[model samples]
Target: MSDWEDEAEEPSAGKQRPRAPASTPWMPPQSHKQRSYREEGGDQPPTRERAWEPRGQREGDRGGFRRPEERSWSSRELPRQPETVTGGGWSRDFRRQEANRELASAPLCFRLDSSVVGTVIGRGGSKIRELEESSGSRIKITKGDYDSEVKIFGSSEQQDKAKTMIDDLLERYDERPETDTRFGYKEIRPSRSADMSTTVTAPVKRGINWASLRENREKYEIMKWADLPPMEKNFYKEASNIASMSQDEVTRWRKDNNNIICDDLKEGQKRPIPNPIRNFRDAFDHFPEIMSTIKKVGFDRPTPIQSQAWPIVLQGIDLIGIAQTGTGKTLAYLLPGFIHLDLQPLPKNERLGPGMLVLAPTRELALQVKAECSKYTYKGFKSICIYGGGDRKGQINVVTKGVDIVIATPGRLNDLQMNNFINLKSITYLVLDEADRMLDMGFEPQIMKILIDIRPDRQTIMTSATWPDGVRRLAKSYLKDPLMVYVGTLDLAAVNTVEQRVFIIPEEEKRAFTLHFIDSLKPKDKVLIFVGKKIIVDDLASDFSLQGIAVQSLHGNREQCDREQALDDFKKGIVRILVATDLASRGLDVHDITHVFNFDFPRNIEEYVHRIGRTGRAGRTGESVTLVTRKDWKVASELISILERANQEVPEELFEMAERYKHFKIKKDSERDMIPRQGRWRDNP
Candidate 1:
């Protein structure tokens, strides 16, 4: 009979059934003599088949072979025990137990709402599986009567990591809008009440509590009035009353100082706007060092912008100073900034970064602010200027060392901020100097990016030569309850100290007119020639250099070092003429700039005002001569308005050119209206 038939036979009452052949084909067929030897329990070499057999089964066991129905359910389902050696050696089961003990940790459990449980688990449980793999833990979800309990089993580190990931996932789901399929529409969920509480055993009854999260996660405390030290609070209180002028007194003071305007004051909600300070002593009475610095710098009295801006800023109010350039707007903000830095509750050592920040539009302006900062040092505070084309690594090094003030151009500051090279969390005072110029240069996006890192409650002071729509939008977005202080009328106008002259000449005669005007300048005159293009600046600068005139050029194409040198030479009177583009139109502060020659009309009238205001600084009389051609007719009306506002002569030729352009524009619009609409031309009878 075959071995299969023999194994299938039933055994007699007392006799055991014969064993079957090994199922694996790799085992050679055993001879009858070997089978008889194994059946008699004779010692023989162990085969691969015997090594894999279940423990406690002997070769002669009568019940080793049985039908499937005879096996118990538990015996079939349970895992086979690991084989144990008869000698004194560690078993596989012992090692597994030891590993389990080492990895054992208390399971972390959290409850999620039944509605959001699917979101956490994802389809096919892929998200939960991914979380388990990434966090090195085993996650199990058990649906209870009220909510689903998520339990994580792993080491303590793994459990914490899993918990954090789950919390983040829950937060994202909480932010999503709730949808109801039965209603077939999306509805806004009402905010949870403050008194509502979350139970440990129940689902998160409310959305993620952001206030609680912030309290647990914030690394630093935001500065506020209640957090101020006793001494700093007392100092601010005393300084608040230093203005000492009543509302009537303030009105009279503002009127006397060129009708200085203050707007957007919250009448009853806050303290009354402080009065204008006549002298440095009035505002800086508590800080003798500041007063001494002002005296040392020989500032007899504050300018119009500074006079009103001082009280508002020193009172810790956000300000939008709409003053023309060169009206001491820099000092107006800088002096108050120094006091603000000094009066902060946190000391310099405790601050994460600089306490004050000044954002300028150009490298030249940034350096100028730095120079001003150097002149008025307080309590050994240090300031750094960061801009493109400078030593970036050196700037980073200086910042790492420590700085109390940072004056930077927006581009380089944004670069540093994105790369995490600078921290703005500690900035309590910020100055957007030349804000309109910054917007004109297309730095608004970069400025917005840099401001994202700064604490929102920081006091901001924005100074613009002209308040254009872009600047207004930026101010509205960033400033809170800001007070406005403008030196002159809010409408665009040049400084009154400059004599404005306009000559209507052909575009071809502009260079000759500029040359003739240069010839008329006295030996003591310092002229700033403004052109529209970089090529013009270079071409005119080259022509003047050939004529043996002491001249330098300033434009964006020039290297930063060369630009700085040119500006320095111009400021020190080493060069009598500095031909530049509108780059120098704003924040080019040279007290001796006696002449501004506009060789080419600016793109807009606002730039024209800024170009002329560069001269006539610090109560000094200066002259600006503009050469307007046919190409500049569009802006003639604005030019006329600006000239009239400044009480300067409005040339008859300018008015005629403006009238001609107006008539031409009206005719063009009429012709455009008469044209048939697209796709409707055939319908026109």
Candidate 2:
């Protein structure tokens, strides 16, 4: 039987069944799987199936199952929102916003009952200003023949407040809108609550497209999800439960295997999006402006992620993308956002409230995302990067003035939100990049709060290098029926583009070892040095400088301007080496970084992967050398696995070192006192 078919019909050995509670999350039913399998005429379609599959995949798939510790990142009082609110027209419609969120300045437009429109608007537009000031918002009352659209512009808090005040004012006229007398029809009104305000008033297009009624069912493949019949939504509703991974556990997979799991696939099962277009010419056939902009930037072909991702995103599917850094993941999300905006533009003259939000784990990553956005938005797209340590007034001014895209760190975003510097009510596209790190840094409360405000109508896209319990919990909490895409191995490991080497040396000898290796690198090649602490980063940089090596340091202690300058210098080849803590590991992307030197080997493989990922990105070949000691034996096995996969030689001595700590481990209740193993090494001479 094929992977799509039910193996349970002829099972032998025990296999774990998917155990996630059906009520908490949604998945396509098994009966539908049977039907899909039977209907599919041919054998398993030829596609990119590789290193790892979903956690829930059974015997047929090469599933890597590791039960994460049971823990809740949700230590809050926020009420759990139902997946789909039941039996309320306004409630259902509120969650289903159809506005052009790409326009940051689009106002909240809602229909006010014609009977009470006069009461809310008041004479000579008098009450509008009063309502605006009282709720810290701007209001515009545009009256139609029977109903009026009371447009609101402000922070979500302000809009919610103003909507409430308007609702209370309109309470003076309790009677329903008067029935239309000309048609002899008693008003068969769609039910609506007073407080509800929808951003789009455009009539929803209905009826089947004749284009989809062709021979051989060709139209079914090309039809956009937005234009698909109502039943199509339900068809894709039942998909697999999406989750995340931890930073440790080394698994190296190739990018050529761009497999994506959709609503039609079972758990751990993935199928690449069909008809994957190769270049801009084909992919952007419908997106001419975007195609022109990309061509101007000299992009001839879309990266592996972009080629597969663009088609799915263009279909308006909520996506969870897993691709290595420097693979153009930013453009994968941003380009789609731009295309969506172009296709369904916001009303002209709207104020600047970002319709699309890209949340990154760190300031550096946020800035990078913004920089990439600027390139793609060459068609007069404006964006701002928000993080702490920059000018607060400048951020507030630019954001409030208006921007098409907003890239921000969670902490600074939370700060701006509290001060009413920005509003996310109309945010249609949400991208959470490096989501696991955000949780690792304890930004759960801030992320959760932001989600609460933009709960309904938002299309969320979360991407992370590894899938940890935290990321899994987050995916469960916010996303609905999201499509999970895995370009490489889902397991945590270094990017395949880098050549790796590990040397077992004493801790005190690491300095000399790194210096020896540094002397061998090309003078112009940028080298990144990773240490465990900020003090180590600074001390190493200072020591390297005193030794006549041009090096710079980056960590939390350095001023924002200094950090930016350090990165700038490194990128420009003015600085040859950069010493940094793990802060620069994940999101820091610089092209042509020839080498990554690990002065102090990290305790886990996750840190190792992220550090090396900085070097070999965007199809560039790079090298990573690690100075290991007996203390790092816990990670030695995984490190060996990485070395073996990369076709690099692993010294047999590594096993000898591994035996020292692997067999007789340190006991938690040991009676002996802990002492540092200061290795005896030859002096600097």
lDDT of 1: 0.76
Worst 10 residues of 1 by lDDT: 181-190
Stretches of candidate 2 above 4 Å error? 1-275, 665-685
What digit string (tens of lDDT, one per residue) describes model 2 on residues 584-628?
897888897899988888756767777888988888899888888
- Whole-model lDDT values for every prediction: 0.76, 0.66
Clashing residue pairs in candidate 1 are none
Tens-digit lDDT track of model 1 for 463-540: 988988766866677787889888878899888999999999988888887888889889999999998999989998
Global fold similarity of model 1 (TM-score): 0.67
| Model 2 TM-score, all chains together | 0.59
User: Would you estimate the TM-scores of all the predictions?
Assistant: 0.67, 0.59
